[model samples]
Target: MLYAAINAKDHAVYTLSTVHSWRISLSISPPSPLPPSQMTQEQYILASQPNPLQRTGCAQAYPVGIYGWRKRCLYFFILLLLVTMIVNLALTIWILKVMNFTVDGMGNLRVTKEGIRLEGVSEFLLPLYVKEIQSRRDSPLIMQSDRNVTVNARNNIGQLTGQLTVGSEMVEAQCQRFEVRSSDGERVLFSADEQEISIGTEKLKVTGNEGVVFEHSVETSHVRAEPFQDLKLESPTRTLTLEAPKGVEVSAGVGEFKASCRKDLTLESTEGDIFLNANTIRLGNLPHGTTDPLLAPGTTYAKQTVYEVCVCPSGKLYLSPAESASTCQTTNSVCLWS
Candidate 1:
């Protein structure tokens, strides 16, 4: 029985050893250090991670990765700022273009690619020539002056801006409000009321007030007043002076006429006619129309010259004969041969 037991124990021990050997043979072996190609998925992933320069999107969970993320954020912010700046600049340029579209320094007035445009003004005054005046709609320019108002519609559009009142006796151009426009050395003037306006190519003059008058003539381009009155005139030739009495006579030949004083006036001309109108008349020297030694009241009766003179209704006068010193005191005194 003891030997059997011993044999059984030995048998069991052998069986256990054989089973252990079998299990050992079936078990998986511990893996060797990975080779370059045989590395695990985790190891491969770690190795394939990009370098700092090549990295994109999120970095790995490391201090270096955190620094890279901050740098990326900074770059993104800078890019965003650049985009915003570009957008703002575009908007500003657009706004400025829109604001200055209608007006321009070169075209002081309204102008288009097709032609120039002039707005109708109530009044205007100009000292230069007008090269061109383009008007829109049916607005007119009312001009008043003592000088002649010239309308040069040679190449004008006939836009009929307004009418011109020249050499007006009522309103004066000197103290009036007016507007003017000029381009390329050309000027245009406009006014609303009557005015003593002088308009010509070279010069322009205006006269105001009751005694204000203008004289335009082709023969003797002269302007004169009786006394105590303002006269403005422009002519192509010389100036002439004539004197007359209030109730005597008044005359005009041609051209424009103006009177400032009143006196018995007699106007007679051999070649041309005379112009006489209502005006103030001052008792002045008879012949020369100026204060002179010979024209005093108590002077001797020297000689009679042909000149139109003004005498009061019953004023006393001494007429002397040219041959001798004989004086006559008759109303109808004439050299009679009796």
Candidate 2:
């Protein structure tokens, strides 16, 4: 090997001696880091790059990421909610449509024709108005319904004004007069204006007048009158009369009342007053001191002394067993005792 030194301008003017060796060695140093300002554009871009796996795996979900599953769950939940809301809205609309109703001037919804259907009325969502409401058939306008019929109204005021018949009984009613006729030729007449009611039968004719008002509830069954009036009752053959306080008036038809009260009794007529007469009789409890039975034969105990009673035959009253004497003597002994 030879070593030489020379000047660029004068290569022959500057020269160096050379030495030759048997072995030649060369050393390589590690490369230096390039300064940020001095680095090439490619090097700078590569050095500042984000992780490639992070970017790619997020864009296309890998097994480790839950992005895809969460999206699917969100969509399914939204769809289920939408379906449920739609169904609820449909049901609400149907219920509202079925319940729609209105009332007429007579406070009635006259559905006389057959095959007519109504819904939601039992729910009472719509207003109801009438005096008394009942579903009835026998009129040409209304067909007989085997199905359970329901009538919704405030009261049956309008329906009671016309004639109605059930079985052999005929009912004639108006704003004031109410009549009921039986199959056995019995008839009952009631009037609103006059405090009088009449029930006609083959064996007996019961008549109630204004005086009967105070002794009976105006709403007494089989009889009719203003609810506020007083009542009194009388039997001409028995020559008996009965009276009660203002609200204690009661009427039980036929001989039914005989079982509840005795044949001859006198009680306070009104709250503060007491009226008594020779033939006027009030009722006591059952003859045996037992409660009145629901029903009994007319002459159930005519032969027995089931009750303790005072007798006033023509006002000469006496106390005796029914079997001992059929009549109370009008003798001086009995009268003097009284």
Candidate 3:
């Protein structure tokens, strides 16, 4: 559409009109060929600090920083993620320490759903204390320590039941009674206490490689035999000595008493007269005996033929001929005993 228009009657009259137009523009350029004093001007830009670099013309370059919002946000997110991971790791370690987690159980020790377990021997640089231990089976429970091993047992009410202590120099087992049992668990092989020591089997045998000596008397001691069997005491070398300070007496309740010797058997009194008191007195092996001092003439037995019995004042026996019997009775002397 035309901005200037005429009516039909006026359009025929507008043919000779002349057109007029105008143009507009804006600029901040300096004036041409001005004096240096007149060209002095100032411009203020709201921008960041600029870097020190070569500049040209009347314009300056403000330094470019983290370029855009996306880059700055990316860097900040990365830093935040790193901090979060570090904190999570620190907290996990602290929890493990407080709960006593088995970090050392990486090798021989194991941590499982059931509990903490040990697969093999674990030697610690320091002493180990724990609530329990599972060890080998069917073997002796031997514990070794340089100093000592003490075992104490307590009942449910906290009363002590037994105490066993073993050390470098001494060992002690304290209880009312101590028992030793067989591996088969059939019977008690031996049992002892402060007042009694019992041997449950048929016989008790004590032996040693060199010598077995019982030096002190025991309390409530006994040696028993099997059913209907005899209790025997023996020394294989035939050397045994038993002494009592008081006088000795022998009695046979239901059996005959017998005395045996390999050589001479002598009964002598040092300060009293010898007496034989019995319902009937009978001498054995009268003339056939050979322990007479006067008859020991270094000759064989066949060389001596006849002998007589002599009586001494000290009740000792001697041999004499029948013809010297009357003289033997009057020749009584204590020397006849020898």
Candidate 4:
């Protein structure tokens, strides 16, 4: 690099050569700055420069404050910044006036004297969970839908306990069992399940405005029926007794009437006679309880064979074998119970 060394007293100039990396120090040979008297103002300024050989035109000429085009650029930048700040402040005021912002509310929802009012439709992307929802005016909460509405009761584990679905034409419920309870919640008015259905408070009475009807047979603990069809009653393991307060009647006018038993059958009447009214009476194989038999007039043996039924005069019965079976006809000798 080349630098000019000027002698102020003679106005002579000298050219000095040095490398760019070395410091620009005229007093480097002696390690002391030059005395102020022999140095002119220009030479003193030239020697005091730390980078005298590298000149960047006006920057090196006037080194303190911004000057010339750079000064103009700094002023223009300050003006532009002020204008930008003014424009931003104006826009901010305009937006505040247009939007009418408030600190107490958010967005379009505003708090008024009556209640809170939301301007647009509020859509929830996720499930809205709330404990209780009610009207502010203490009225019933009215929710209307075009098609169906459903309500579900869930446990803490998110398992559904019950579900009530109401459609346009029908309403359905899903649960294990269903019961209609009384107003006081004491008794069940109606209950239903897969097994049985019960009604009333102990007794069930049908008003039968259209008459009670049974399409098929009904079997319960005490009463049973086959409706208007044929019905039969049988005892499988125990004895069956038919009793009534007044009388028990069994009528088979057009059909045959027959009765048989696996064991012995006894018919006893305490106040009335057991009348057998038929055109003909038939008897099967039987034995009679008797001790004496007729002597056949010649023999005197009491060995009775084929003892027949005989009626006494007192209407009491005792078996006797005369010449033939007789109700009360006694020709030779009459035997009566003693």
Candidate 5:
């Protein structure tokens, strides 16, 4: 049998004979190409050695297919980085624009170099501390409180011009009292309690469209009116009483006075004099006959005879003639002499 072998070191081919058990060396021939499975160690080592010209920092060159896949992955990463940067920049710009619009678009509000200006209904929920509050307009400004509102200024003053109306609503004040006082805290100019309103100053004048009514009694120390005017007391269907602990006096200057009662009139003097004065004196409704004999002194006549009489200044009674008796007595408080 003939067998061939290759030298691992020199890559030389050799022939061998196994029947005689002898090895024969042939003439050196160039090694033939072998399959990868049959490749010598020298050939494997030569194939595995890197090419000096192509050698770099990386160990070896990649295959063509894998190199293409690496290129595609690099491109995808760069594109992803650019898209992320653009999205971040756009988001930042949009956020800044939204903030600018919100700060500038407030109605009736301005931010200037001098200060801030607030117009129209401006309300504050938090506590606002300021030096002063003032109104520049000439029209009336109203401040109202639903419950109670207090204004405290320690080192400043509050001033109001024109008419001030307090508690104008029909509802009363919650505190039930309103007062105006001077700086000294002693004098009260005006005050109102629950039932009474008082003005403590010099003069008070009240004019009501209807009539002023005093529900209870009215008492004063003194009352005086100027000039001559009629003081009238009227009660349509009720009793009007005037009572005094001391005494009541009425004086009319140079005016004629009269008193009349529709029912009955009485003149009573408890402890003083009742004086009736006029230019002339008259009496009526006297009894025709005197019951006492002393009242008709020295006069004797029949029962049917009537007499007209008069009382003279000398304290004597005189009788008229019989014809004038009926006529003189019929006239009102007049004595007709015949």
Candidate 6:
């Protein structure tokens, strides 16, 4: 029984020592040098476990040192900034080269060239104000507008060597009156609502319309009418006088003619014969039935000397040389000689 008891005590001590040594070995044992392919599942799991002696913090928790998610974002931002700055510097250099500007010793920037060329369409939003706009080249400066354009000036003068043409459906000038004057001021074409056309010291010509009319008296050196048709003269209640150096001749188509002169009527021709012809003849104040001897064409006679004629009661006529006639046997009437 004593020996058995001693053996049991030794077994307990050995088992305890074995357990303590195993724990100590486990605590201080180095990891296996073998690769994952050669290591056992349990050894691999042991090697993969986190080291307790290693430092652990917010920064150290990530696989890459000092390069966490936040740090990556900051790095990308800085990289983008650097790239943008480099691009801006390059564009600035290009612009400066294109502009051709130079800096002088006085630190003033100046244009080194004369011309400036723009690539694309350029627009100016503000008004293009200028004191004067002039074209230096021979090409004309043209301004075009889709709608109406007006120019207003207090005084405007235009001298054109070439012809001026105005084309439109209608053109009008409006004012109280208008006048066109010659250089010497002697000739003018004046027009107004109240005043008629007055042409001074110049010939007035009107065409392509109705004939002219004289509202008042017209005194001219001569008057001429050249018409394609007939010429007419009208005097309603006035006298018309036509005086010419030569004689007057009137010719017309076959028509009746009648002329009446008031008071005394005289028919005289300086170098022409007088002709009187008709179907019948009448003399003095006698009617057509009178049988007097004077009505006979060859009965009336006249002597060159003065004479007096006497008419008797029997209708017999006798003549005497004296103013008184008493030679008739019957009572006689004295007649005066003509």
Global fold similarity of model 2 (TM-score): 0.20
Model 2 misplacement above 4 A = 1-70, 82-128, 131-188, 192-338
Q: Model 6, range 250-338, lDDT digits (tens) per residue?
A: 44445434544455445677798867676864333211121133333333233334434445454444553332443232213222221
RMSD of each: 22.5, 25.4, 17.9, 15.7, 18.3, 23.8
Residue by residue across 138-174, what tens digits does model 4's lDDT show?
5455555567667788899999988878999999988
Scored by CA lDDT, what does every candidate get? 0.42, 0.42, 0.55, 0.59, 0.54, 0.44
Instruction: Give per-candidate clash totals.
Output: 38, 21, 1, 0, 0, 0
- For each candidate in turn, the TM-score is 0.21, 0.20, 0.42, 0.32, 0.36, 0.24
Encode model 1's per-residue lDDT on 51-84: one tens digit a residue.
Answer: 3333244322222123468879988999999999
Give per-residue lDDT, candidate 6, residue 265. 45
Off by over 4 Å in 3: 1-116, 122-142, 201-210, 216-314, 321-327, 335-338
- The top-ranked prediction according to TM-score is 3
Itemize residue pairs with steric clashes in candidate 6. none
What's the CA error at residue 246 for candidate 3, in Å? 20
Residues forming the 10-long window of minimal summed lDDT in candidate 6: 9-18
Model 5 lDDT tens row, 117-191: 555566565446676554437844445555433443333355322223244454433344678887898999899
223-281, model 2: which lDDT tens digit per residue? 44345543344453454433343444455443233323455444533446654444667
Model 1, C-alpha of 45: deviation from truth (Å) = 32
- The lDDT of model 6 is 0.44
Query: What TM-score does prediction 4 earn?
Result: 0.32
**What 10-residue stretch in candidate 4 is worst by lDDT?**
23-32
For candidate 5, what is the TM-score? 0.36
Sort the predicted structures by TM-score, highest score first: 3, 5, 4, 6, 1, 2
* lDDT agreement of model 1 with the native: 0.42
